[model samples]
Target chain A: MKNIYVAFCCEYKKVSHSKMLWITIVLFTFIPMMMGLMIYVVRHPEISAKMGLIAAKASLFGNADWPAFFGILHQSVATIGLIGYGFVAAWIFGREHSERTMKDLIALPISRSYIVTAKFLVAIVWCLFLSVILIAVGLMMGKWVGISGWSHEVFVHGMTKYFVTSFMTLLLITPVAFFAGYGRGIIVPIGFVIITLILSQFIAIAGFGAFFPWAIPGLNTVPEGTEGMQLFPISYVILVLTCLAGYLGTLAWWRFADHHS
Target chain B: MEEIITTEKLSKQYKDVLAVSDLSLHVRKGEIYGFLGLNGAGKTTTIRMLLGMINATSGSAHINGMKVHAGNTNLWKDIGYLVEVPYAYSELTVRENLEIVRRLRFLDDKHVVDAIIDRLNLTQYAHRKAKNLSLGNAQRLGLAKAMIHNPQILILDEPSNGLDPAGIYEIRELLTSLSKDQGVTVFISSHILGEVSRFATRIGIIHEGKLIKEINSEHLEQLCKKRLRVKTKNNILAREVLLQNNLICEEIHDNMFELESESAIANPDEIATLLVNKGVPPTMLNVVEEDLESYFLRTIGIKGGAK
Candidate 1:
């Protein structure tokens, strides 16, 4: 356990100092700011007309109230959260291979599984930090734009869905960790994330969001009861099963596979 | 002498290509075993197998009586290694890279980082990122990480690569002292035979994934081919006199007679006397020993000289 702690500390140090961490934070901040600009333009039609084509795009969100704002935030988290969290997993695990430092990790006093665990721990922490920042910045931007219908009950309701959506997205990132290990670098894993994100849209449109692990979070964020977006308990089961498979597969790969590089 | 490292017919077949085949060798305690091989000669593959970074197709490698496998993490507590071109976290500083190793090795002493940096003459570059380092300084960082824990054994692959002559000499001196005074068993692999011959207590030559020869560094001098080089004012007469005496002599391009016969080399004074008796009057007479490079090539049969 001490060995694992030590490895985790080392892994944390590597991630905390990385430029990628700051870049991801800054990138996630822009999403909420963009959403706030759309809200602001919708609240004032004169400005929307002056904005022209971008205003037409912003008006597509229907209204400028807190409910519309929170709905947009929830859906954004479900989609953007997958890519952001997957990238975090990819960087944490694939950087060793990309930097040609994988050989150094082997033959150490600590077990290979500990190293894998440490990497996953760092990835989880990084993703959670990003998720928190996205919501915090989104709330600030919504208040800045002065969207109406703000209440304690509504805020509580919105944040609960936000946190759950983020949790579900986090759970789905484990398979990405497996891809980073099996593919031995970031390119393959990032490709996997992209393909899964596209397929999630198709799967949800085909009325099978609960059956697909990647589409479950987006379905859950769809305002509680939307026609085909109903999520069954079996969806969570599939997600948990996927998470277990990816986690165990990565550990087994690290422990048993030949690391020629 | 106790064997600190031993391999028995270890083989690794990567699909159709055999990277290592039937390789068996031993490294004794306090001995610097130089694993000499050319590029693609299975030196790195063998070292990787010893570290359990790759699984051997057959046989096994043991370090300190523990069989080498991924689960044998205890054995690595006493082993430090640098495989191939050493790479660190490029974004991390040199000190940070060493600190990571120190933490992973579970060394409680925080001062070991500064000490290793100072010892490797990397104090000035301690805060410099690894990507900005020159090849020689990067190599030093690699060596520092391997030596930070002061492990009982070191497994380095092509350690002297990308270092200046002075850096190479410094590393050689450091390894020699560690092996001689601290009883550190060093298993270093290098294609440069001349460099390894300087400090290795013993050397095993591998060619085409096979252990072709193993020789003690002390006896390497005697084993290297030597020739009696005779440079005289009249080279023709010197050659004729030596040939008539049943001495096999060949005239090289620089107007000198080379007598490769064991008798002539052992009794060079006799040849000198014979040359002077014929009035050839030798200008220079010396027995030149073949250098490690030539000896290595000759042993590997690449020089085309008779075995």
Candidate 2:
């Protein structure tokens, strides 16, 4: 327990001192702000004449109300959150190899598993912080746009769904963390995330998102009564199992693999 | 003396390439063991296995009688190491990097960081980010990280690399002091036998993934060959006279006769007398000992930098 804490402190220092943290914050902030801009354009069609392509893009949202805005935010969190959160995990685990600093960590008095756990903890906090930013900024944007249909029940339900979607997306990052270590850098893991993202979209379209771990998070964004969109109980089991495999894989790689790098 | 570090039949095979082959050696407490090898000669691989960063395919390594493995984190408490090129978090400052190492090493006192920085002559660069540091200073920071906790054993691979002449001398003196005063056992690896011969108590030469030779520094001189080189005014007549007298002589360069015979080397004055009698007086008669570099190359079967 003490070893994990010490390792966590060291990992936190690295994250706090890095530019990647601020970069992710700005990116998460920008994503929701852009979503808000689209809502604003839809709210006032007069601005559509001046906004050109952005106005045309906002037309896809149909109605500029709280439910519609919350729906879009949930979907955005599922997709954008996966990429963003995966990037965070990739950087956290891969930076050691890209910077040739893994050797220092592997042979320390502290177990490598502790260091790996600390990294995951930091990555989790960082990704959750980004999720919070997305929701907060999105809420502020909705208030600024003055979209109608605001209610206490809607806010609570929207927040619960949004956070649940975000939580599911967060669980998927364990595989990204594993790839980062196995690949020994950020590029391979980022590539893996991209491939999974593309596959999730296709697999969900094919009605198999319930079985695919990467597709499960995005499918959670769909409304409950939608035809063919409802998830099975086993979907949760598969997702949890995938998360465990990734977590165990990462720990085992760090503990057993020959780290020539 | 207690053998604090030991490897028995240790070997590593990488998909058909044998990196370290059945190597066995031991380092007694407080002795500086210099590991000498050419490039791709498995010095770093051995160090990695010893540090538990990598596993041996067929054998084992032990530190203070404890087996080395990734799960054996307790074994690292008394061991400090720097492998190949030392790399740190480029964005962190020197002080910050050392502080991270201190925390990871479980040292509560923050003063150890400053003390190691001062000891390594890195006080001026403490606040400087590692990315901005020159190669020499970066190497210093790596050494600082290894020594901050002041472990009982230091396994360093080419610790003196990227340092200026004075910096090299300073590190040499510092390492010598550490071993002498603190009883810190050092296992350092380098390709430069000349430099390692200066302070290493014992030297091990590894070539083609095998330990070919291990000798004490005191016995290294005796192993080096000696020859009497005589430069005479009339080399042609001198060579003939030495040959006629049953002393094998070869004209090495610029009319200088090199006599490798024990009789000639043991009694240079007798050769001088014989040369004087033959009226081909010697100008320069000096006994030349082979340098460490040449001896190392010869031992590796690569004389004069060629295989």
Candidate 3:
């Protein structure tokens, strides 16, 4: 309980940092809203399922023909979340080095790994908070657009895929958060994540997206009936583990940061 | 009491450059230890290694007797830090920034930060965004961030780097009180020797990745430093006078000789008068001391011995 409180406080500090506040809020709050907007745009009656929802879902939910509510949630955790988190976290991590804050934070009496874990937790919480807001907004939009309760199975499958797949993706992306957690510089982790994402797609064309970190979209691949199985129990765990890795990494940095500071 | 931090032969290598060489350092519990060096003397690098931000090529360090590692990070609960510049969310309000740190350090009692705010006199400015604060205020906020957790140890890097004189004095006083009253062990660094000397009880100078000098404030005080800038009619004459007097004049410019008084009995200003009496019109004759700037220059030999 004490450690958790400590870690919680550790992460909470970042939320208040005036420098990265807007970025944090945007990535954590507004991006989901944007995801909803895009879904709302693509699902207009004018674009009615010309291909019976492949393009429809792609246009709106990226792959899920979800109802207004679930569609927004699906898109956020997957595509939109990736783009938003990528730049934000990357810069946040890089700022430590660029701004040279690593010297101070690491020398605190706290455990180094705990700092890393705390940050990872902060990012996850940010993601979760955004996901919930997006879900609420999407549901409201559904009611507004009068597409409420549309039982589109493909939508359920796709949303579930993203929800569940985000975990595995998180597991795969743990190293990235780890790198950025301490990289403090833009070049190393940003370049690595971008190249990895692009290569994941190419390799998948060679049938390796199954193993590629970019395969997040693929894992949101409905395993027929299991649906969004990963979200309810698994991917969220990945989020936890990802957060854990970050926390641990931060702790490690703290332990030895004295020299660097 | 056990040593709070001890590094045995710690060194950091950045590809080709050895930022910190094999260095052994010791800081006793509750001591205010200052790491001093010129720019790029590996001060930042040394701090990074102590915090475990970067790996050491070879060596080990312990914090409160525990070897630096993941499981040991919880020990950070007892530490506070303010790096070169505070890394904060620029958009968040000061209150918000404190909140994030409070939550991240997992501190539930707001009193810790409230106390720090009161002490730092940051409450009136608390509502403003941290980015909106000026450099000195930012430094205050950074100190607040580090101390908010009420840790027993503070590792601060150049806490007074960018601040006005009053601000610098306030921070120094605060640090002094933290050590004397609260019993917090502080590890701080500054390139400016005078600044570090204001609050540091002990000082260690690192030059070119090596721990060249580690002296207590008492010893540093007895070093008998005197700064004399004497202007002679001819640069050659000034050089001859300074060399003959066995004074290692640091900067010799046209018609001017600048150096530290090499002995206790020697009066540099008196030497200037003698030169004037000997027929050189005294353009500028001043004996300035009471700081570590020149001693630092001579000791560290700034920037690989040339500058």
Candidate 4:
């Protein structure tokens, strides 16, 4: 666990990632605010006009449910956290491939699984920094927008869904990270993700395309009239499955995969 | 002596390519076994399999008789690994890295950790960040980190990869002396054969992902024969005599001839006498033991790949 934390904090202190987190929050929060403010200033829209737009765009954007917020959160995490996780984890294992430090680490009496677990947990922790900032932005944006019908039901259901989704989403993204770590190349994971995304369209023809790790961020789209009742979709079940799958993927790879480092 | 580590026909394959094929290795208690191989020879992969980092395609491996698995192995508690170059949290202090290892290994004794730090001469640099330390100092910290838990089996893969000559010597001295002093069985995988020549009692050669041979250090010495080199003023006469006597003579250069002979029997005086009998005892005569460099080249059959 201490080893886990040490590995986790690797990205927090690195200047490049620190700058990325700051830049994400600053840009994401301010860009939305600027866009919202522009509508008010230029159009001087009537309340009816805004309400009409919400009513019309309900399928697209209006409900603004926890799933939607978390969906966007998943995208942010996937785009930013996925890259960081894969890159850092790549560096973590790749350092051994690129240099001789792997010998220094493996000769220890410690188990290699523990080392991999520590790195996986560390990547999770570092990725969480991005989520923490995003959640803060979400809180601030909710208050500023005066979108308060805040209920314990919404908070509990949404927060659970958010956390579980993040954990499960990490499970999905991390397998690629395992490849990145073992491959120890800068472009390996990046190329993997791009190819996966491109080919995913053909793969998604199946009903459980929702179960595919790439589509996890957008799993929860609340249909009309069930807004108040907290019913997690069957797709949400895929989160635990995916998390289990991710852990097993890492274990299997570690068990069978060659360490180029 | 107890066998601390053993591998039974352990093999690892990558796709169509086999990286480690049918390796069976035995490491005795309190012995330093140097695993010799060049780059791309699968030394690290073998260690990783033993450490349970990768699963074997076939066969089995055990540390302290416990079978290697992906996770949840008690063997890790008994082993310490230094993979390649030493690394820790670059931003964290040296003490922090050592503390993490100690804590992860679950040693309650702060005194033990501190004692290791003191012995490693890292007390002064305890507060300094790992990345800030020199390569040698970083290696010292890595060694300290591995030793902090006091594991019985120490598996180091290329530990001297980035160290200077002095640092390499220190590490060699440290590992060689570590077993007798601390009762630790050390398995050191290195491409640097000479460093471990005097340092390891048993040796294993990995060539092209195959465990080409496993031999006792003494047998390795035998295979690495000591040649009797004689340079006479009249090389043609000496060559003619050696050929007529059915002695194996290799022409090293224009004037020098190398013969396969027992150094104990064929001393410089003996060689000089032999040359005198041939009426050409007019130059250098020396008996030298076969070194690891020559032995490795001859065994692997790849020329100019000297270390």
Q: Which predicted model would earn the best DockQ?
A: 2
lDDT of 1 at B116: 95
User: What does candidate 2's lDDT look like per residue over B1-307, in tens digits?
Assistant: 9999999999999999999999999999999999999999999999999998888999999998999999988998888898988999998999999999999999999999999999999999999999999999999999999899989999999998999999999999999999999999999999999999999999999999999999999999999999999998888889999999898887786767798999889999999999999998899999999999989998999966789
Relative to the real complex, the DockQ score for model 1 comes to 0.76
Scored by lDDT, model 1 comes in at 0.91
Q: Write the per-residue lDDT of candidate 3 for residues B134-193, one digit (tens) a residue.
A: 888888888888888778888888998668898899988988898899888899988888
For candidate 2, lDDT tens digit of each residue in A143-214? Answer: 998989999999999999999999999998899999998999999999999999999999999989899998
Number of backbone collisions per candidate = 0, 0, 85, 28
Evaluation by TM-score, superior candidate among 1 and 2: 2
Per-residue lDDT for B100-177 in model 1, tens only?
999999999999999999999999999999999999999999999999999999999999989999999999999999
Off by over 4 Å in 2: B230-241, B249-257, B272-284
**Candidate 3 chain B lowest-lDDT run of ten:** B260-269
lDDT for predicted candidate 2 compared with the true structure:
0.93
TM-score ranking, high to low: 2, 1, 4, 3
Looking at model 2, the pairs that clash are none
DockQ of each: 0.76, 0.85, 0.35, 0.21
| lDDT for each candidate structure | 0.91, 0.93, 0.66, 0.66
* iRMS values for every prediction: 0.7, 0.7, 4.8, 4.8
